[model samples]
Target: MLVLFLIATTSSVGFAQIYDLGGMYTYHYRDGRYSDWGDFSLHGSRIAIDELNESGVLGGARIRMTNENTIDYHCWPENAALMAETLMKKGILVLTGAGCSGPAVDIARVAEKYKIPVISNGSNASMLSSAEEFPYFVRVVSPSEQYEGYLINVAAHFGVEEIAYFYTTDAWGLGARDVIHEYTQQRDINIAQEYSYPRDTPYDEIKSYMNKVKQAGIRHIVNTSPTPDTVMIFRALHELEMNEPGYSFYAAEMISADEAPEVVAGSLGYFAPMVELVPSPKLSQFRDALEKRLGKPVDPSSKAFFYGALSYDHMLAVGYAIRDIQDAGESVTSQNMMTYLRRMDFDGTTGHVSLVRGTNDRANMPIQIVNSHGYKDNGTTVDFVSVGRVDPATGELILNEDSIVWPGNVTTPPKQ
Candidate 1:
């Protein structure tokens, strides 16, 4: 029930000079954990609004935001529809942060009905790319299908011929499991194991599954699960002595290493090869202001903040679209927002994002798959280092093999 209204003017703003924005956050418990990532989205959006006000983009018009939190009681459509319908009733069209797919899907459902825009950094569900399905739902994060083809190629570059795809049963996880399987299968990559588990499966149970994969000779694995679940599974692997010199792995790439929680640091599964998503320089400026406000380094590699850049862009895009609506002397309806947003192209805090013509998918920034590793002595500190980057066009991971920090305190890439 935490609603924050961000009125973006300095002072003495007329009633007509303000835009009402909505933030539909998906926050609640999954398994026995509480994740408050909504806090980050709300914070980032406010920062973007403040910057827009400072830059005088509104000319006097301000942005007043009302946040709605859907506790994700059932992880289904009904919850999303209720929250979205509530926001639309308040005359809010530009919304941010439905951090997962199920809620995002339903939010899209309501967005189309109301003609409002639902933007998020965490809504990377492959289906979100369809212009037909979720026309009003836009996301800053690259879609899973867009990245899956690239990720599998990146894995193959690391001499990983035998790989495994493990995921939870949630919408996001199931979507990932199916897509990755298809991508790898098309490439004739040997998916040594396709492990699936319940979303609330215990860590011990997950470890038991890992044991079976270990027996099947899966030296390289790519895990697509919620960060908390990954953290727990990593802990189990460490306890079971399965993480060794020859083992390599990947976690959800959309969550940057810097944004990973402290508990993830010392775990071996959290330390591995990497991928980096680059935003544009203009977007970086906006991102810098927010990072400075948050007392974090603006450098994308700093890892002090992970998803902020993407979410920052979401806010900026909303601001831009709102400003356009005012400038054009048009009513701020969902239809106008979509028309402008679809036609809009600019360098926001994330990078050059163009909503491709006829498709709602973003013509995303070039993604990099890097050969990176981290070694942490404790929960808070990680020797996060990147020795090489994958050429997005060629899928060539040009890595400095000499700098790889292997398990067993070794500092070299596994003999390929």
Candidate 2:
């Protein structure tokens, strides 16, 4: 029952052959301290390759995943240029998962100059999609800037006034903080106080900042730190007694169920552009088959599934695009793949994905907030807040035609 379906079945068309595909390396910015987590981008990349191999999508096409060593995130742009150059020289077909915004944009520039196809797993800054700058880049994740509007509306909807910005000192956090700051100002709201800490910061160093957060007389907080820093913030809040009622916290892009729920447990809430709630029959079948293969339940938030799903969809897109060009007897080159990607569309785990020609040019794929301590398959455990569709222009969240407010939700804690 192994059938390889081509987009267009023609006599000239043939079952796609895996032509020595490899690579999918991640470049991290933090000093090598967090290397053990491996790159989150690599997780989605691995899942794509593994699923392809198992499903016989390419009829046993081989794909290799690797990593680029770097101690700093700023070095990612240069590191990405280096990795793309080395791999392109070796004839690697696709480059996916540039860990964050700077590196992702850099990789896209390099890929375009050399005509290599680059897809992003994490680089959500809107600028990457800007047509004037990046012509060869496409990311499965929605732009982080668009999500800010959702953040503001979500906060406003909950009657949050005073807000604090607790962000990591990195490209992703800085970029988002800048965008959210601009929008919030344009809307006539100022951040009560802004606090920052570097990655791998000691808890002692954050105490004063935590005190400032407590003293801001603010009722809400917006954090842009990664998983570890996020955990530390929550732990600090507990010790500082900042987790009590009358205060709430909002975060973007770090809601994987893999992390201990305690990080966000007592907080009011957190937000991300999207979470894959709509189970794709394709995704479910893939999940079931993967569980059977691994002989264990896969961590839904594990890098394995994220990168794997991204990579699988990436290749599937490539496969369809290639078939389209091949039907016209056109040569399958990086340049043509780039052209096809802009026009190709299909359903995958993340939802409907497409491309536009400018930085921050991508559409906001609806919003979902989690109120639970952790994600789950059971219906009763997870409480979802669909905060209406975000109108990117003017930075406003239009209440959904039918918004559902969960009963007995967590309330904000009063500031000391």
Candidate 3:
């Protein structure tokens, strides 16, 4: 049975006329591995709402997301569709949330059917790039396809002629797997073997899969799994003694620096739609405000922080669209909102946010390649450092080869 969890909204300014915005999120995963992402995202959205209303961005119109409207779908597709329809019935101008790909896809379908716009902070499945299929769907993050080229480049950088690929059997994982296959083929990089695992595969089964990869003598591996599953994969590799010199691991998702650091140390990975946050007074103020609201220090290097920043930008985009529509002496409707959203270009917390002209994905968002290495400032601490980046403007793959601490604490790429 599917259950909907409602999040209580923050205080809102009283207005005679209010614009309704709905949210569908995964506040609690079955194993509670991803709840922090949902919680932080909700806080970010609420903060944006409060600021937008207080700043009088919409003049007489204020945005309101009530507790009853924000539904937690638990990352289930069925629940997402159902919850989206429930909110649409209330005449929401735009639908927000959908922190994961499965729920994001479902919500997009529902929004398309109703001719309403849906903005996502976390969903990055490549299939969502189809404007024809999901005309009303847009995301603050780049699609999974954008990361594949960088992954292939990293493999080629290490002189890897072949790689073993592992991915989960889910929307995000499958989308990433397909794109990687296309990219590797284009680059003439051989895929030695492909392994697909269910999201809930047991530890022993993962270990067995690792053993098979070891038997195959594949030193270059690329994994496209969520962070939780990535942790288990690293554990299995550690147990098999395969996460050492001469064995390279690359991930499609970013893992927390504090999560099983001993196992994932020296692994290379990329997270999309992010650039180093430009230091500005506004950026600093936003960080301070967000940290105060979250009751914790915001680690710009952390994945959760990026998600939160994207969520904040998600609301800002919506607010800006509504403001533009009203400024044009037009009624704030779904169609008008969609119009302004597609042309959105602004400096957001996550950097400059803009949608591609035809596709639903963001444009000119850089992908950063990070190495899980010991922080040079504090040698005892393991953290992710920017070793390379895909230049957003030129699509150039830039690597600081001398700075990367490769697997087994080596300052050079391990030969395959």
Top of the candidates by TM-score: 3
Could you tell me the lDDT of residue 131 within candidate 3?
Answer: 86
Error of 3 at 90 (Å): 2.9
Relative to the true structure, candidate 2 reaches a TM of 0.74
Q: Write the residue-wise lDDT of candidate 3 on 25-92 in tens digits.
A: 66676566556667778888998999999998888788989999898777665566888999998899
RMSD of 1: 6.2
> For residues 1-416, could you state the per-residue lDDT of candidate 2 as single tens digits?
12334435542345445443334443333443342123433444455566555665443234444443212243344465766666676666666555456566666777777777776555677566575577777766667766655676566665566688888766666777887787677655668888876666887777678777777666577777665566677666656767555666666644334444444443324454444435678777666655665576765544345545554555556555655666766776777877776766777665565555443233444344433333445522223345455443345466542333221133332333
lDDT of 1 by residue, 120-224 (tens): 766777777788887887776666765555566556656667777778876677778777788677767788777788665787888788788778777777777
Instruction: Return whichever of 1 and 3 wins on TM-score.
Output: 3
Scored by lDDT, the top model is 3
Estimate every model's Cα lDDT from 0 to 1.
0.63, 0.57, 0.77
- Model 1 alpha-carbon drift over 4 Å, by segment: 1-13, 26-38, 67-78, 254-288, 295-304, 370-372, 375-379, 387-403, 407-409
How well does candidate 1 match the true structure in TM-score terms?
0.82
**Clashing pairs for predicted structure model 1, backbone only:** 6-65, 115-334, 258-303, 279-350, 280-350, 280-351, 283-348, 283-349
Candidate 2, residue 379: Cα displacement in angstroms equals 17
Better of 2 and 3 by TM-score: 3
Worst 10-residue lDDT window for candidate 2 reads: 404-413
Question: RMSD to native for every prediction?
Answer: 6.2, 6.8, 7.1
lDDT score, candidate 1, position 103: 68
